[model samples]
Structure formats: C-alpha cells, structure tokens
Target chain A: MTALPMEAEILTRREESPGLFTLHLRLTDSAAQQAYRFRPGQFNMLYLYGVGEVPISIVSDPREARHIGHTIRAVGRVTRGLERLRPGDRLGLRGPFGNGWPLGDCEQRDVIVVTGGLGCAPVTGAVQYLMRRRERFGHVNIVQGVKHADDLLWREQYECWDRMPDTTVLIAADEAGPLWPWHVGRVTDLFDRLRFDPAQAIVLCCGPEGMMLAVAEQLQERGIAAERIWLSLERNMQCGIGLCGHCQLGPKFVCRDGPVFSWREIAPLLRVRGR
Target chain B: MATDCTLVAELRFLAAADRQRLIEALREAGYAVHGPRVQEGVIRYAPVERIEDLPRGWRDIQEPGRYRLRQTDENRLFAWAAPAASLKPLVFPPREILFHARRDADGRLRFEAADGAAPKLAVLGVRACDLAGLYLQDRHFLQGAHPDEAYRRRRRKLFLVAVHCAHPADTCFCAATGDGPVARYGFDLAISELEEGWLLEARSHAGQEILDALPTRAAGETQRKAAEAAFRQAAAAQRRRLPGGDLPARLGGRLDAELWQAVGRRCLACGNCTAVCPSCFCHAHVEETPLTGARTTRLRQWDSCFTAGHSLLHGRPVREDTASRYRQWLTHKLSGWHEQYGRSGCSGCGRCITWCPEGIDITAEAAAIAGEEA
Candidate 1:
C-alpha cells in the first residue's frame, strides 16, 4: 500500500513563537498508533482537509509511541490552514518517513549539534534522546543561531538542556539587544569560544543550505573528516516516498534516501548550480 | 522455461485476415483488447474490436515540433514507431483518487482506500521502447520499498503484445539505447510483420495458450528470414545515436558549461518534453472538497521538472530561473538518474525530440557537451 493519510486527532497545541506551533496528535485507530513509530529526524506528511499536505519533522520523544508531536511553521497554504487548527480538531497524517539521524553512530563519541533559526525543530528529538542516555555519550554541545532574540524557540527546553551533566548550550544572534545574553555574531564565531577534539566529535548540522555549507567548511578546516559531518537538507516534497522526483538533490531523494545525509555523499552535487 | 522456448521456436504465420481471430481469442479469454486507432487525425491507443480499428495503411512523419499522418497504399498493421502516448497512462493514470474521507454520523471521520481490482487488458501493437519503458516503470512502482497499490493493481492485469518496428521514425534513436527494433523481453507475445504475413512468437505460458487457440500454420524458413532482414533494416536506418562512453559522469562534470544557457534560451519550459517522456514519473497531489466540507477526496496528477514550483523547499524555489530548471531536467535524466536507479533514465525513444516545440534534441545536446569535454 502507498502512503495514505490516516485520521488523527490533536491532543494538544502549543505556540512556541509567532506563526510556529507544535501539535501533539494521536491516531484515532489504536492499531495504527501502535504500528506507527519514528526515529529522531524522521518526518510525517500532515494533511488538512480541503488543503494540501506538507512534510514536517517529528519532534516528540521517540519513546512515546502513543502520541506523535510535530513542529509546524506557517509558510505555505497547507501550513497556514494547519495553523487555524485547535486542540479538538482532526487532521490527516502519513509517514514517519525518510532516514533518521544516525544516533547509534554517536555512541561513546562526543556529539556536536549546530542549527540556525527553525532548523532546531528537526533535531530536537535527537537532542532529547541523547539527554535521556547522557552517560552513553561524551560531551554534548549544541550551538544555535537566530537573527533576533524573538526568533528563539523552545527557550525553556534549552535551559533544561544546559542543566544536564556534561552538556553545553551556546546561543548566538546576528543583532542582539540588552535582553539577549549571548554573543553578537554568527554561529561559526561561537566555535572559537568552545574547545573540543575534532577527531572525537560527530557533528550534526541543519540550517539554510548556505549556512550549513559554511559550517561544514569551517569544521573541515579544523581537522574534522567530511564523513563525520552530517547535515539535514530540505526540498520540495510531494510524496514521502522516492517515486515523486520533486525532492531530488542529485541522486538522493530528500524525502526517501534522506532528509539527513553525510556530507561526503552530497558534497559533489552541492557544488553544482541548481543541483 | 525450456518448453516455452521450444514453443517460441515453433513459429506460426498469422495472415492479415487471421488478426481478427487473435482479437476474438483475447476477448474470449476475458480481456478487453486495446490497440491504435485514428483519432483526431492522429493515431492513438484505444479500445478495438477488430483489425479494421488498427491504423492500417497509415504512416506518420515525425520531426522536431511537427507530426503529420499520411495515407499509404500499402497495407500494414504496425508501421508507426509510437504514438504521443505510451503505456504510462494505462498503468499510471493522469489523475487518480487515492482515497476519500467523510464525517460519519458520530461526528468522527471515516476513510476508505480507492478500488484495488482492475480489469484484465490486452494491449496490441506495443513498440519495443514502450515495452522497455514498462519494465523501467515496474522497477520504480513495484520494486520500491512501498509499492504503489494502484499501479500494481493495474499492472498485474495487463497483457502485452509487442510489435517489432519495421519503419524507424526520423526522431527515433532506440537502436543506440539498445532498447528497440526488436522486443527482447517483458512481453507475453511478440510479432514481426513481413509483406506476406505476421510471424508470431510466444514468450510465456499464457502467450503459448493464446497462440494455441488461434488458427495459425507453421512459418516457413523464407518468412522467418524476411522478418529478420526487416528488423535489421530498421536498426540500420536510425539517424541519431547518443555519444558513447560514461554519459552520466560526463554530464555531471559539465554542470557549469555554457551549453545549458544556450539551450535554455530556446527552451520554453512548457514541460512537453517530460509529458511525452516514457520514463518521467513526477507527480503532485491535490485535494477536492465540496461546499458542505463533510467530505474530502485526495487526487494525484502528473508533474514536470520544468515548472518553477517543482523545487519549492519552503516559499522559495531552489531553481528560480528557466536556465536552472532546464539544467535540472537534463542533468537528472541523463546523469543523476544512473546514481539513483542504477540505470539511465532516458529510454532513447525520441518522444521528447519529436514533441518539443523548440526542436531541442537531447542527443544533439549531449553530443555538443561531450565533444567539448573530449
């Protein structure tokens, strides 16, 4: 059977920022709820009646099998329709698709997460997972960047992450006022303030393509192998499966082969224009 | 398998009059037979009841941006290379309702999937490139991690009868692609037409049973030789051949070449190349809801890479200009496709060349790029 959206009810809705909200959904069918399980960095195709479907990453803790959480930003027609949804409203959902972050590979190794603006939503699940099993991993470093202080999401959660043992949270803004308590520069500048052995770290970065490319290049200059750096990419997705050729980035289908890929695999294609 | 090969070797001659009997046999075996017929002054695939429905004594002149049908005095069943349409529409409809949802009496929504069973269909006069295209589509829709239920249902009930091309079109390059002039596999029954009669060869158990039911006599050695010579002539007559050696790698390296901009100037981004392409399978989804808002139906339609919306990540499109979109289509088809599917995406059917309004030939573009690098 191909991807068909199942009816789901919104259990709760929380607004993290203006035009950005998180919905906790439960599949009406109990059997389907049990069948649907996702890993961190995987996404679901959320559908609204009379509107279209859009791919959103699952931010809920993976251990919770009953309720699925998705962070959505009102950017397009489908998302704008989704923004009007209330706690009791119903919606359609399919997937838990695409390859997720390689959590197992980070075991016994120091982990570094670099994100910008709304890019943190996709990797939030991975961060939560790592914190739950903190002893299994080494140093946990998260570096986030935003244009202004108001753009920061999950502020309370970032505070909680900082309290965890052996964890480091670094936040930066391009233009900061008195209210902001972080460095006033780009995310790459924060890398200078932190200290870590590049050989022992696995870097996971997601943001605009230009930002991610800059981060990857800087990390490579610091002696990190290209293979150890992983990045999450975004593209126009219609079908969550690989059949629809819309999400193609060179040979890889962002919807299927990845929304997450190692830098080594996509480096050549990234250099080409329009690819 | 050995027995089936021997059955194939036991060739039979099907006279022009006996072709009607074959259609009758197919209908009697619970299949709705479909074939090419003249519609809107052009030959198109449609339901057929008899041999008269075929495009008999008709041939087409196809060039870049031009197609014209001319009447011929000679009587032949399969003279055209292919119509504007391929097996794509039959298996993957242009628009299909994936499912429907409606509110129930309890104020909860109920969903039901689309119908699964499809009618048994026997399509006659399928060209070799179309047969190859069908196999390629099978690898995509059926062999994937999540098989397309609708495509699988329709494909399961299909019975293919392939016809060897005796007259290659001006835009045809199937000989270079190693896909045509003769049907190799993926067909139940294949036919090679000669001046005297049609030589029938069955390649499957079901095909053997159908051949047994038909009234046919053993094909003579002279008839077999004539069929072989005709296929050879068709292959030799091809005017276009893709440049040899590592096409995927060569095209990938030329992403910054100036040739794409020159081609993009003439290219209208009209999506006709992708629409006529036998292997293009991109699609977009749409939802329909009545004023009542009680029910919603989700449907999928064919999409093309030439459109600006094809690469929309958020509100912004990655390939915002015509040059980039054209480059994406060509690079994906000739170069990137090999990395993803382990095979070249183009079947070299030349439909893109003939149907292109700007007369842009892929073979010529590839040659120009390849020659510059060499």
Candidate 2:
C-alpha cells in the first residue's frame, strides 16, 4: 500500500510572477530536519501521474524548509498538468538531481546579480545564500527586469532589497507604465547604473537568452573578461545523472558540465548566430 | 577448409516419423518446448505439445511492416530470417521491476526487490542477426557499467536453440553489421535445417545432454552439405545491404550536418523506429501508489527518445523543434553512440524502415552520406 504524503499541510502558494510561482509545500518529509538537504539552484523533477514528470529548479534554501518550494512556470504537457492542480493534492517526486550553484565560491567577492523573469529561480538560491551571510561578501547589487510590473517575480523581496544598506537594487521593465517609477527601459539600458571593478565583483546573470547575451556582452565590455562572468545555460535535462543524452547544445552535457558556466569557458565552443 | 568448430557437437538425424519420439524424450527431460508453427498467414512461435506442432513445409517472406508464409512442396525448416517480434522483450520485459516499497503503518518506509527468480528459457528459434542484436544489447544493459541485474539473471539461465536463416528479407541489414543470417553465441544447440532432416550440432553441454536423452542417430556429410546450401540461399535472398566497415566512424562525424534537418522534415518523431526494432532498449520508470498512499518505484516500461519530456526542461523542451529531435535520434544511432558504447546502436533489422509510417530507410541515408563524399 502507498504511504501518506506527509503530516505537514501546505501553508499557501503565491504566484511570484508569470511562468514563476512559489509553492510552500508542507515539510512532511521530516519536521526535525527544518529544510530538506538541497544545494542552491539544484532542480527537482516533479512527477504527476496521468500526465508525467517535469524538472523545476528548487528556489528555496537548505536552511529554511518549513515547506518545500519551487518557482514553476507552465509550458508543456507535464508542467501544464501541474498548473491544473489545486491547493491540496499528492505530488510525485523523482529527485533533487544535477549540481546546484557553488556555495563555497560565493564568500570571497562582492556579488553582482542580474536576473530577468523566470531566470530568477536559480538566482533566489544565491540570494538566500548571500542574505543569510551578508557580511561574508562585499557590497551586493541586484539588477532585475521583466515585461511589466506584474512580471516582477518577488515584489516584497525587491522592496526588502531596496531597503537594505549597501544593497542597490535596479529594477526595470521593458515598456513604461504611467505610474511605474524606477526605470522604464530594457534592463540592458540600466548598464550605466552598475559599478564595475570586474576584479572586485563577480557577475552572475540568468534570464532569457536575449537578456543573458546582452548582459554578458555588457560585462565583457566592462573589462570583465568572459572568465569573470557566469551565465546559466538552459538545456533539456532528463535523468540528471547524465544518463539521458537530451540537452546537448554541443558536445557538452548540460546536466553534467553545467546549467551554469563562465562565458570564457563556453564562448569559444558556442557558435552564436548573427542577431 | 575447416569443416566444423571446436564448440560444435555432431549428432544424428531423426527420420520424419521419429520427430514425436524425440519431442517426447525432451518433454520427459523437463523442458518447456517452443517452436515455429504456421497460423494466420505467417510463421509464429508457439508452445509446442508434440513434434507435429513444428511448421513443416512452411516458409516466410518479410517485407516492410508485413510478414507472410507460403507452403512449399519440400518440408524444409529454418527457411525464414527471423520473427517479427524480437527476443528483446523476452530478456528485458517491456516493463520490469526496479524496486518495490511499502509505507508502514508507523509511517516508516520499506523497500523490496521486485523481479522474482529467473526462469530457464529454451528459446527455440533466434536468427543470426537477432543474436547479434542480443550481443549488442548485452553490451548496453548486461555488460555495461550500470548492469541491469534482472536481465543478466534471465540471460544466464536460458537455453538457446539457434536456427540459421535460409531466406533473407528485404529489411535485413545483418550482412553489413557482421551480425548475420544465423545464430552465433550463447546457443546450446544450433540447427541448420535441411530437406532430408535437421543438421543437429550441439554448441554446448546442455544441447549435448538433451541430444543424449533423445532417440536420435548420427548425421552424414550429405545432410550437412544440404544445410549449408540452404543457408547460402538465405543470405542471397536479402534485398538491403548496409555498405562499408567504417559506418560506425562515418556516421559519427556527420552528427551536426544539416542532413539531419532534411531527415527531420520527413520523420514524425513517433519513436516507432526504435520501438519495433530488435536492438533498441531505451526504457522509463514509474512508481505506483496504492490507496494507502505508499509508493513503489517501478523501472517497468518502455520510453522512447521521441518523448518530449525525455529531452525537455523548464517547461521548455530541449529539442523544441521536431527537426532537432530528429537530428539527435539519427546522430545517436549512426555516430554519437560509438563514442559512449563502442558500436552503432542499429542491428540491421529493417523493422525501423518497414514499420516507419514514412518508411524512412536507414540504408538510403547511409547511401546519402556515401554519395556526398564521392
């Protein structure tokens, strides 16, 4: 016979933004274990039978596990299958597979995080890592963008970030709103607002390919060699142990080598087409 | 010229009447016998009760996606290439167990092994190309780093009765892959059926043991000669021939070529090409939860590369376009697989072409590569 889902019930689910949601799964796996053991940016392949399985990045921290969480967007069959689920229901699971962000590497440099739209999921882990140990790093600046005010993933967090001392949050949207305050242009135009020493600060950028390309290019222009910039690559990753050969942008197995890479590491191998 | 192999055990031929006698001897020896019998216009393998169940004077012709049998005046056996269904499902069941589990009343969890004891299978009629396929799959699921233990258990316990091909079909590409038209390995007994009687040669002790128990006599040189002639005729009948020894290497180099897009335009990406093929062994897993809400993770199902989820991510599919997906499948088949597995994944079983809704021929694609070079 099958066992129960767990003792803890879901607190609530919040729509962070379009294609991104925060599901506060009740920590029924174990209560003593506050947070499930997960590294930053590691993904869970959520399974829903009658529909199938789809992988979503775990945006929560290992230190905080009141409920399991993910920023999921509806896309294909399985994700669409999941979007239809109401508050309380059984969810199947396969893994927290693949390598997450390097927790050990974040301590030394002042962090410059740039994210847009759904790309915020992976960055949230790094954000939680930094916020928990704010003094370990130097200054922290987060530059984020979306299509509109509604596209902003975490408005509360952004407001919280705007309040923090030594933290400069540059928020932008693609099109201007009559009441929209901070900025009213593509996030790429906000490059003038960023402080770049290149050596002192490590830049990590994630978002749509177009924005990633633009930010990465902007960083390269700032005397930050491609090696200094880390770009999260997207590929179709199934069976995160590198068994399924799904996401091969080239010879690299994105599931194994990275969903993250230094631009210099992949730049030569990456043959970008003319824009 | 060498007339026999070190593994070959010579045995006597049974007259037409002694067929039942030998069958009875085998039944007494505790074997579940299976052999070919004609039904519904084709030759099919069924559990035989007596020697009479064997298809006599039965011959088959295989075309793309179809198989048919015809009666001949001469009662020759081993007159077909191979069966429509592969031995792949027999060794590696369509769905089989990875692990079983129960969530205890205390809310604790326990896991159990699902696959039971392996049965001793007496496989009566696997062809040469099919054996090569088994050999190939053995490298994938059996001999690989992550060995499929359940498959290994079943394989080690089986009794193979290898039947040589006396007729090749249009889809047979065994000649190119060096796999065959006849049984090559793990066979207890190899039978090259002749018009007068079967040329019985035991390749292992189990086959000899079975022979010793049966009421049988020694086969003469004339009987063996007739069998060889028939075997040659089988090889001659094939219509498709995969060209060159460098296929594994050649196919590897062209993975990124735009030719894949060309092929994609025609492919439905249904994965039926791999499904019916004798050599393809990709699989998926599922866990069944009872009303009690405990889960049992089952490694019990077939999953094809054609599955969107197999290569999708972030609700964004990796092979978002059917064209790239097509490219990946063919590239893996012809080239990329050799990098990881040391051989092309194809077994020259033309079922992929025949069963294809588009009838996309790999031979034509291979020729296309060769043509571009010349």
- The local lDDT score (0 to 100) that residue A103 gets in candidate 2 is 52
Per-residue lDDT value at A122 in model 1? 90
Residues A113-148, candidate 1: write the lDDT tens digits.
999989998999999999999999989999999988
Residue B289 of model 1 has an lDDT of 91
> Over the stretch B11-104, how does candidate 2's per-residue lDDT look in tens digits?
5676666656545655666666666767666665667787667776667666655666777877765566666666777777777766565555
Residue B300 lDDT, candidate 1, scale 0-100: 86
Worst 10 residues of 1 chain B by lDDT: B1-10
For candidate 1, what's the TM-score of chain A, rounded to 2 decimals? 0.98
First chain TM-score in every candidate?
A: 0.98, 0.87
Q: Individual DockQ of the candidates?
A: 0.72, 0.14
Worst 10 residues of 2 chain B by lDDT: B1-10
Top candidate (lDDT): 1
Give the top-scoring candidate (DockQ). 1
